[model samples]
Target chain A: MKFAFLILLTASMALAVDKIKLVSTTTDLAWAAQQVAGVHAEVRSLLNGTENPHFVDTVPEFIRLVGEAHIVCLVGMELEIGWMPKVLSRSGNAQVQPGGKGYCEVGSAVTPLEKPTGAIDRSMGDIHPAGNPHFWLSPKALAQASTAIRDALVRVDPQHLADYTKNQQALAKSLEDLHQKNMARLAPALAKLKGPAVIEYHKEFTYFFDAYGIKSFGSIEEKPGIPPSAGRIAEIAVAAQSAGVKLTLAGEYAPSKTLERFSELSGIKAERLATSIQPKGKNKGYIEFQNSLVETVLAALSLN
Target chain B: MLKNRSLLILFSLVCFSQAARPEAAGTGLQISVAGDIVGNFLGTADNRLLPREGEVVLYAPIDQTWDGALNLAAHNEDGEYKFEIHELTIGSSRLIPRSRFKVGQYFLGVGRLNQTHRHDWPFTSAPKVQTQFLYEEGVNDTGAEYSYLWPTPFYLDLTLGITNGWTFGHTHDEGKGPVLPTHYLRLVTYNDLFLDGGLQTGLNYLGRKDSSGNNTSLFGLDLTAKWREAQTLTFLFQSELWYRIYSPAAGDVENTIGFYAYPQYGFSPSWSLGVRVDGYSVLNSKDAGGNNVGSFDYGLVPTFSYKASEFSTIRASYGVKGRLSQGAVSNTEHFLELQAVFILGSHPAHDF
Candidate 1:
């Protein structure tokens, strides 16, 4: 009878554990959620740092994670349109569906850059219908996103609202400190550069560029999400060289061969940096991820 | 009794109106149009260039707990264009906890490929097993399905459904009412093999009893495994096997078995190559005169595809059908086909 009582007590305790299970579609969002939820929740990311957030494959593990989650943080703005909907619909977790108490779209908190004004279609090559979804690269945007996540957590677990609000404020302060430090250091170095500061592989670095007051000549791919032809590549290389572009930047997940060939042809240094926070290894947290990317860009421009 | 019935009707109308109110402001209809144009070669004279199929789908959020969709499909039939209402569904996953419910017409989820639209198929040709056991486009009927995800350590899902059985396969007739409707149950499970790799398997059973007491039952098993990297599918292996038993009211009972296996490799982000082998056999079948009428047919198809972007694809496939009798195999027919599929507007996301 004593042994059975112990077993029942353990089962009840397990059931009573009130840890919110939060699942985010991207690692950066997961990092922000972790900061807001802290010890009161378990945060997991569906996509690691290296995966392309635009075209993730809906794996079974993702479904299981979402199905068990009390809250799901979406980058939204169509960044995960190719896969997240499928996972959400199949997860059968109504609590995390759109408009539910636990459904949070972090991207909705920020006014994104490059919102297309006029008519848009596939001729633009896989353009996001809403706007650029790389707002996490900006500290101000990330702070706003953290607030959204905190609101979602409070809605789901009202008893811990104070904890969430406190954590969110702490995170916002740290993000602001980090942003000011980077801006102070980067402003002088960027002012010393000649002509455009960089050329990017895609528009993923738009927020980063905007945050640092950097000027980007253009993208390697003339049409977003489409591979550049040989002629197109040559044209961009020549134009970048003539325009005195200092560096070309891309996410590490991009094809290395393309970056190298462009660098060789244009005589501009190339740097591929991490765009998402890693689950492990270096650059594990959001702050570290931002710092590493900034350092890489500065080093590529010979200003580090 | 009449007063009670009238009150119940009024209450239902009020409930439906509340449930169907627009969920949010500025929400409008989402429409998607896709088409498949095919060119046939190395075949008979009748096999000329034609548009394979076109589909127009519209979706809207009815309210917080409900959504609706309509799919209109058109295809070329015997040098003429034929159109049909492919699917119309009202679905909700938030009405209940850990469960989803859908009512109206839809493509039956019997196998992996059955639920997927043909334009999204990896290959340009349909496998013999799919065409023989099911229809070329699988089966679509007015039905209601309820899916539940069991709470477990791994991913396990169960779906049960029933559909009107007036006519099976592709038919245009408004047939008489059936004595028994078609009912199906499917169980799905999966395992994570490695990073970015997943293997999913499903088992399905469907049965129907016609007005004439003729009974039909089917069993199916399907598997799909895919390994991918950023925007690149590295490898994929998919297969489906099925068994059918048909017991007529008077004639002899017949059994049919079929299967298809496809393995594909992606050499680059935009290009892929794959081959499919499929075969089906009928056992203990008889003609109208009561003579033995058992037969077997098999097909081999090899295909290649180039994806320009998410919006378009160009695929070429060669298929050859053969028959094995006694101790020799005889080739019966062959065709080389090419298809281009393009999508416009906001297409719905496909399930894994």
Candidate 2:
């Protein structure tokens, strides 16, 4: 009789301490969710830092992770449209399905940039018609996303509403401060750049450049997500030189040789930046990620 | 005063219209199409260029609880185009706890390659074993399936399904229904091999009774493993082994076993090389003297692929098959095949 009572007591304790499980499609969102849900929820991310969010393998492990989640946070606006739908459909978890209380799309908080205004098709090379979904690069956008994620958490765990709300306020303040500090530091460098500041490999840095008041003249690839021909590269080099572009920037995953040839033709330096934070590596959080981007761009422009 | 009242009423009408809108943004039919064009040299080939298979798929959520898909497929046969309804399924993962179900017509969850669309296959062609035991592509029929994932330390999934067995294999003509419907059970498990690697394995069983009172039972084992570094696949290995028992109402019961093994290595993000070996055997056969003999055959194929992007791929393969009769080589055939696959829009993610 004593042993039975002990077993019953242990089971009740376990149930009482059960934590909410949250799954995010990207690492940045996972970091934000962890900040707000601290000690009250378990947060997991699907992709590590290095992967291209556009094309992801629909691995079985994702299904398992999402199946046990109370909330599934994703960067919406077609950023994860390729694989997230498949994962959600196979998860067999009703709570996280679309229209459910736990289906959280944090991207809805931000007003996206470069949203297509007219009819668009594949001729443009795998474009997201809704907008550029890489809004996390901008500190202001990430703060908005954090607020949206906080609301989602409260809907699922109303008992912890005050805690989440207070945490979100702190996070938003920190991000705003970081944004102001970086802009002030980069103000002198921004004044020195010519008509157009940089030439990028893809449109990944649109929000980043906008935040810092940097003007981008062109992209190495004539079309997004498509490898450009040598002729196209040569044309871009001529146009960039005439436009007085100062630097070329690309993600590490881009073709190194192409960037090298473009740099040679344009007589400008090229810099490769980490597109996302490496939680397990050097850049461990969102703040480090933003700092790395600013430092890399400064060094590339010979301003630091 | 009258003009003011008219303006207020118009404003309320506009507000009511906007509020009454029921459909959410971005909820529309997702349409995708894929096609495969193949050319064979050093063997009997088609007179002209023709697509091996062209498929158009439409999918959308029926409501908050259900989603539906319709697949229309066309292929060239005997220098003519034939169109058919490949699959039409309505499914939902939210209907039960840790469980999902789909009803209508779909490919059975059996071996590794059976459930995957052929256009999405890494290689150019199906194996000899798969073609002999199953259809050249796969077996698709009207079916209902229930899949459940058990709460365990590791990933374990169980699937139970039943299909109307009107006919077996690929056929153009409608036939009489079978005496018993096809039933299948599959159990799959997955494990992380390393930080960037995963391995999935499954065991499957399918059985049916034909109109002639003959029973056919198939048992299958499949394994798939992949390892990636820096967002590029470095190694992939897929294999499947199947054994079939054919019990005739009046005759000696026969059995057949077959297997295919494929291993691929990625040279770069856009380039990969792979080789596939196929082995098959009939356990019981009769010679001219009515002696119980066995026949075995094997094929070797090496393929290379270059993916221009997610929407297009180009592949080339060389294959050679050898048939063994009574411990003696009977015949050999060789072929060089080239294939191109393209996707037009919103391609669904392939299952792993």
Candidate 3:
């Protein structure tokens, strides 16, 4: 009986040491969590690359995943505003509730852009009054988010603190290396496109544009979440043409007609850029996803 | 007029009290404000265009585990302005494990549509069945609600509640004080469906007693299914059925049944079209003398909505209603309505 009890205890401990379940609201955060947790955690994202994070539905799967999660990471700043509240409320998991020790808002670790001032209303469109939440597009911001995830994981699973720290450091190093290599490859193009004016379909690419030192002339949409009205589109197109903007950028998920209209009116080339790492296929990881974004931007600007 | 003035003062006091609190700016304190305005063009006997209704809602989080909200509305009825407090509720999730406790006056958890705010309804107006059977506003009551999240692999939520039976068509005098309590229970489940869609179903029950010792019970069943492919298109199908039984002191038991079904298709992020069909009927209803007083009403509504942004929406709808009351010939009524809803401040997102 004593031997059997010892064996049972050992087996339970072994199971306890298995991968901690980490759930993230967005694909980018899931990738960062996976990197920081390494083999110590199993990471899953509530949203897919093709789905718009802003409009995710609170499905049953989200509740199930959150209920089993040891930690939940979110972009925060109300990026998941439309569905995260319902998901968390229904999850019934105290560990991932707001203000819980296992809950992490990765956006809080980095300074955000486009924070509104004064009284804000719907006339300004669907804006995150807190700030723009596209910080994952910035490598610096992503590194900070990874570090935050590491700290959160350590708090939830202290036994794997050393491994989390080492993995985070390795991720930071690889990101830095990739950044340097991209800078070298895009130097000539970057020099030519220094503060070059460009038009975009939405406000989602602010962080990426800021990181690459590109000047945003304007967006096709009059406001953040509103579809482009014909009058507003014409107005923006004329402005872009007058400003000598040569390229228009749109997220791969943006409405094709809006991009096409903006490009046609402005006499500029339109390029659809990937917003997140695809769950399947070649662009399945964070590194490849970020690299593709950099290469796409470089190629688009080089043509100009 | 006096009551309306008092309510306005109370509303202002609540707003000012929230504003004066220093903790209102503290972390985890989220406040959201939204407003709805409607304009109607009646093609019936009135045959005139006029501003219909206006409503405002305030939602504030007192802490990480507690939140409160107040809704006030004003509407024109035959050129007279009527004002009322639609809802005032405070909710807390820390009282019980895996449960939420809500207190004060709010929409009763009797049906899916009953809990939804008026401005949030897919159609421009309330369904005829709801208006005929459950009041035009749909079963708002002063209550305490407790919802428990069951420990199941799937999403299953159980809610139990008790409320003052005054608002449930029960006659009560002031001296009577609290006569009877309305009891409510609901079971809700959510599941994933094909094509990246979701299905949610709920069963609800409500039991109440009148000051005259009469008993009334209501049963509701609702289902909602939604499908979306990226931002381009979305499809939604929702249906709800309600049945009620009333036992008076003298007359035989009466039964009332009603249902509404809504199906919507969003061709783009900005445009959506939907239709709603509603039907209600009463059987064996009688007055104190036991004379038959049964009636039936049905309506069909078609709506088109434009979403200007995440926080703003414009909707236009046309409705046709047919009614057959006891001892009267059936008549048809038609009306057109346009509504605009806007959200300001920090509003938490709703569920699918």
Candidate 4:
């Protein structure tokens, strides 16, 4: 009887612990939320890391997650404009609805880059009028996002404010340490590649390129979302060849055929890079994913 | 004059109250405009090229929990421009937990295709079954709806709605002071079948009294399965089945059944192919008073589409339709259609 009583007591206590239900639009945001919330939250991402964030489908499972969540963290800046709005509207969760206290837009924590100064339209190639939303690739920007997410947690659960703040600080320190370590190791190579022009398959790598001091030559796609015409491909090939661009990077989710054709035409080495942490592999954590990306870029440039 | 002034003041106060409350103004206010333009070539006995449809949609957030939208559409009707309101709705999801309420003129949630806009359809033409039962433009009614999300481990949603008994192509006693309201119920569930694949299914029921003191009831079921492999390929299969019963004041019930199936495959980022099969039949040949009414119609459509960008697409489709009266030989009709669609401005993403 004593042993049974003890087991029942422990189970009840476990159930009594109120964990905040958290939902994020992307795997990166979900990782950040988990890091900050620690044991006090349950985090789920709508899209797996392997999928492209911009073209996510608003599946019903996403709505169910949002409907039950106490808070929702998103990269924002219209990065999920294609599907997040519909999911939020259909979720019927007032607490996480836009403008709700539980709605946490981590992107707002950082100053965006590549904001257009002119009138915008589809002619601009599916550009985000709010600016570049790929800031998660930058360690400094991610640190800011963590702080924002921590603050949001405090707002929703003040009882655990201290815990959230402490976790957030720890995450920031770790990120800083990782960034410094990578920068130190790549300092010589980065110096050599400074202002060195490179080609990208899409506009997805602008933030990363800017952070590492690499100049973007041109994109394989004629426009942001538009496919490249043969003439356009030929034009870019000539431009890249003349510019001495040695490396071409494409996201893992980009069309492989296009990347292969671009490489054949431009005579530049093409590399596929992960846009997010692989959900179920060696690069599962944010730090590990960043390390792999930096290492890959360095190797592609023949700097390692 | 005094009453009018009082009503205006009341309306202003309501608006001001919503604007002043920070919580109510959630996420701040946003306004966006979107438009769809289509050019179509219709091939029939009289082959003609025409500018099909131009639609402008406006979305505005009144507050955090409340939003308003208006859809203005212009279509070429017999070489003349006809402008009309496609949808106008004010929706709120904050009144109840895991629930939403929408009121105004909008598409009825009877089936999957009824709630979808023409521009978003994968095929170039509307399915024959849908057009026959809900009219050419689809079923739109002035009404209010409340939908709730069930707190289950899986994805389950239930919706209940009430609307004015005004189905398109049917005229009842419109000038009457009041009539029986149409009632609708819908239950939807979703499941993740495998990696990168999902299945969603729904059941629906609708009951209402027509203008002629007749009872009309409809039962429907819908299923959709989708699979996507990154940016390389995607496949979708969807089907809807509907059965309707109409009972006159002094006759036996009349029964009709309709169904449609659509399958689409995207081979690349810019290219897709789709096929649709539609069929409908009136099951009852005689009423209690012994009236002949049985008929059947069927159609097949195949489409190939190319997307230029996120905002533009071109599609070519071929359709074969057959109509069979109770005592006449089946008459077949064939048509070829080509369409170009372009969207501009900020358009919200559609549901999967």
Off by over 4 Å in 2: A1-17, A241-244, B1-27, B229-232, B290-292
Question: In candidate 2, what are the lDDT values of residues A1-304, reduced to their tens digit?
Answer: 9999999999977865678899999998999999898777889999887778876767788988998899999999888877888788788898998888889999899889999887788888768877888888898988999988898899999999999999999899989999998988788888887588798998888888888888898688888888888999999998998888888888777778889999899897788777787767667899988988888777767787
Q: Write the per-residue lDDT of candidate 2 for residues B1-352, one digit (tens) a residue.
A: 6446546644644553343333444555666779999888775544345589988777777788898887877777777666667889999888898899999988887887888888888888889778877788788888899999887767788999999888776777776779988899999988888867899999999999988888999999999998865435779999999999999978878899999999999876679999999999988878789898787899899999998777788999998988888779866888888999999866886676
Candidate 2, clashing residue pairs? Answer: none
Kindly list the interface RMSD, in angstroms, of each predicted candidate in the order they appear.
1.2, 1.8, 2.2, 1.2
Lowest summed lDDT window (length 10), candidate 1 chain B: B16-25
The stretch of ten residues in a row with the least summed lDDT in candidate 4 chain A is A188-197
Candidate 2: residue A270 Cα off by (Å):
2.8
Q: State what share of the real interface contacts each candidate retains.
A: 0.64, 0.52, 0.42, 0.78
* A275: Cα error in model 1, Å: 1.4
lDDT of 3 by residue, A1-304 (tens): 9999999999988876687989998888898898889888889888888787877777766876786788899999988877887777666666777777788988888888889887775667777878998888877778877888998899899998999999999988887787777667666776675445577788877887777666788688888867878899888888888887777878777888878887888888888877888878756887788778777666666642
Which residue runs does candidate 1 get wrong by more than 4 Å? Answer: A1-16, B1-25, B283-296
Task: Quote model 1's iRMS.
Answer: 1.2
- Report lDDT (Cα) of residue B197, candidate 2: 83
Residue B250's lDDT within candidate 3 is: 81
For TM-score, candidate 2 versus 3, the one ahead is 2
**Global lDDT scores for all candidate models:** 0.84, 0.84, 0.78, 0.79
Model 1 lDDT tens row, A1-304: 9999999999978855778999999888888899999888889888888887887777767888899999999999989888888788788788898878889999899888888877787888877767899899999889988988999999999998999999999999999999999988788888887778799998898898888888889899888888888888889999999999988888877878888889989998888878888867778888788888788777776778
Worst 10 residues of 3 chain B by lDDT: B169-178
Q: Highest DockQ: which candidate? A: 4
Two-way DockQ contest, 1 vs 2, winner: 1
- Across A175-293, the per-residue lDDT of candidate 4 in tens digits comes to 88988888776677767754555788887787777666667886888777677888888889878877878888888878777777778888988888888877788679898888887
Q: What TM-score number comes out for model 4? A: 0.89
